[model samples]
Target: MIHRPRRLRTTPAMRALVREGALTPANLIYPMFVREGISEPTPISAMPGQYQHTLESLADAAREAVEAGVGGLMLFGIPAHTDPTGSQATSPDGILNRGLRVLREAVGDRAVIIADLCLDEFTSHGHCGVLDSEGRVDNDATLPIYAEMAVQQAKAGAHMLGLSGMMDGQVAACRAALDAAGHTDVAILSYAAKYASGFYGPFREAVDSQLKGDRRAYQMDPANRAEAMIEVELDLAEGADVVMVKPASHYLDVVADVSAQIAAPVAAYQVSGEYSMLEAAAANGWIQRERLIAESLTSIHRAGARMIATYWAVEAARMLRNSL
Candidate 1:
């Protein structure tokens, strides 16, 4: 009774002073979708308040996020064309690289610009890699494609590449490619523990994914935890500057474990499904929108994510700044 735990909770000032985790604009990375032919920002129905932007509109969005004090912007492109080899992905004129160029012009070193380094959005088969004659994702073949992609994105002015393909040896391949191309300054943010989760449903729509089958062949299984550490270690050894775990809420344990074991900065993605669920519930009057948004992000931060990729980054950044 003498050591009353409620003493710190007695006042807002006291609570702030003893707060263990702080969620701020500096911790957020906004994930943006850029469509090839769109003239305006097209609203994503599933992810309320989010949009797939045109190059012009995406530049404005990047400006807004930077102005709002968000730490970074992550770009995902929806190309105008798709092919068997995802040839457009390595093209300099491809949607993603174009978007990155636009953002670089708009922000001009104001914030970190990250390109999602994956082929799912550009491939006719909607897989993360090139297919073999037998019709399966060719892991070894995918590494070279990713290496080329890293160089292309770096040339496009991306500050970092979000390597989300889950291909083995991708980090080493990309690192080598980048260094050889004289893009050693561009960082690699490896999706070290990305799991094959249902939480990516809305994201497929966001990127216009043509996936005909599951990515379980490449993405990690959701049931495993220890494997996450191994993935982190491998990516780090292969030259990953940052490591990430996807679907932050569901795999906080993995996030914490990775953060604890690694010297590199750890990131967690609050994927599209997580945003949609809360938005849907809020629209139905089931939850407080602002509070849930803050809570969800704070929980991810508290769970040891040094940076978070979220759909709500700009709004959350504004809110955090206002609170301060």
Candidate 2:
């Protein structure tokens, strides 16, 4: 009886004081999609309230996110052109690189501007890497492109590269490329434990994916948790500044595991499908929108994510500020 745990729960202020982890706007990183050919901001039907922005709108959004106290911004580009090798990914003027440039110029060190260093959106085949003659994703062939893409992204003013390709040796190759190009300061956030989950459906729509099959060959299997540690350790050793686990809501265990063992910070991605589900549920009045949004992000943080990349970054930050 002397323990009296209920004492802390008696008042909202008391519970706030005893909170184990704090979820703030600074911990949220907004993931934005920018389309090369878009003339204006286009709403993504699959992921409501999110847009495939044009360069001008992207710049405006970057300013808005920075003003909202969002800690970082991650850009994914939908190129106007795609080839077998995903040539746009490494091109300086490609959509993602251009978006990075716009973000850096607009935000100006006010927030970290990150580019998605994967070729899926730029590949005609919708795979993360280039394919061999047999059409399977050739891992070795992809590393060099990733390296080249890293340098280009760095040159385009990306503060960080989100290496989400799940390719072997991607981090090492990119690190070497960036260093050689005098971009040693560009950090790499590797998607070390990205799972091939069913939750990526809405993302395919957001990017207008050309994928027919899945990326199971490279992405980690959702059934395996211990395998994540192996990937996490390898990416860290290969020069990943931060390690991430994707689909944050479903993989809180992996997030906790990585955060617990790794000496470095951990990032978790609250991907499009996860965002869609909550939005749909909230719209249907099945769940309380604002409270659930805050709770979902808080749960991810409580599970040990040092940072969370989410679609609701700006809105969530504003809600948090208003609550205070």
Candidate 3:
């Protein structure tokens, strides 16, 4: 009886005080979709509550997140056109860049603005990079475009560029480009251990992705754990201010591994499919939605993620605040 551990679980107050990972609004980053040539917000079919926002609506939402004390806002763009090279990804007037501008003007410096630096949303072929004549993604050819895109995103007022593209040397290329363009102050958030996961299906719908083939060529294989360390190490060497592991809940081991070795802050994404599954279960009355959300986020943090990119950021932030 003297050794009973039930004392901690007996009271909500005891549980709160004993929690190892305290998830605050400061630890959450809200990911959003912004579309060009849309007057009204377009609801994403796969993500019931999320929308491909118009400039006005995107700004409004950024302000809302800022008000909620969320740490950052990540912007993904959908353009009116697509091309073989994903040209708009580097354009100053690109939807992502424009959304960055709108967010800056809307929220000022209240929250960090992180741009999704990838081509899948803009390319006609739906791949993350331009295809060679043989139709394989040309990795070296993609670097220059990514470099230019980084400079443009920096000019657009992104506090940090989320390099989601899995191209080799991308972190170096983007860091060089940002510094050369006098954006030395802007940071890089490298998706160092991104897996080619089935969980991205809902994200494809959210961004209006036109991709016909899988990104397995560049993205890490889901089965590989050791390779994540290699990727994370390379990214850190190449000047990534922060490093990330994607599909966080499924890859907490990778998150924990990366965190254990690096001095840089670690980030993990609870991607679209993860969000959808939780939403579906809640709608079916299978689980308490808010409790699960808080629990899942806390688990990711406990697994060593210093930051978490999630669709439920705002609501979760509010939840954490209320618990105190």
Give candidate 2's TM-score: 0.98
Please give, for residues 31-60, the per-residue lDDT of candidate 2 as tens digits: 999998879999999899999999999999
How many clashes in each candidate? 0, 0, 1
Give, for candidate 3, the lowest lDDT window spanning 10 residues.
315-324
Tell me how candidate 3 scores on lDDT: 0.92
Q: In model 1, which runs have C-alpha deviations exceeding 4 angstroms?
A: none
TM-score between model 3 and native: 0.98
Question: Residue 194's C-alpha lDDT in candidate 1?
Answer: 97
Q: How many residue-pair clashes does candidate 1 contain?
A: 0
Off by over 4 Å in 2: none
Candidates in order, TM-scores: namely 0.99, 0.98, 0.98
Error of model 3, residue 243, in angstroms:
0.6
Better of 1 and 3 by TM-score: 1
Residue 170 in candidate 2, Cα distance off native in Å? 0.3
Residues 183-262 of candidate 1: C-alpha lDDT, one tens digit per residue: 98999999999999999999888888899889998899999999999999999999999999998999999999998887
What are the lDDT scores of the predictions, listed in order? 0.94, 0.93, 0.92
The per-residue C-alpha lDDT of model 2 at residue 131 equals 95
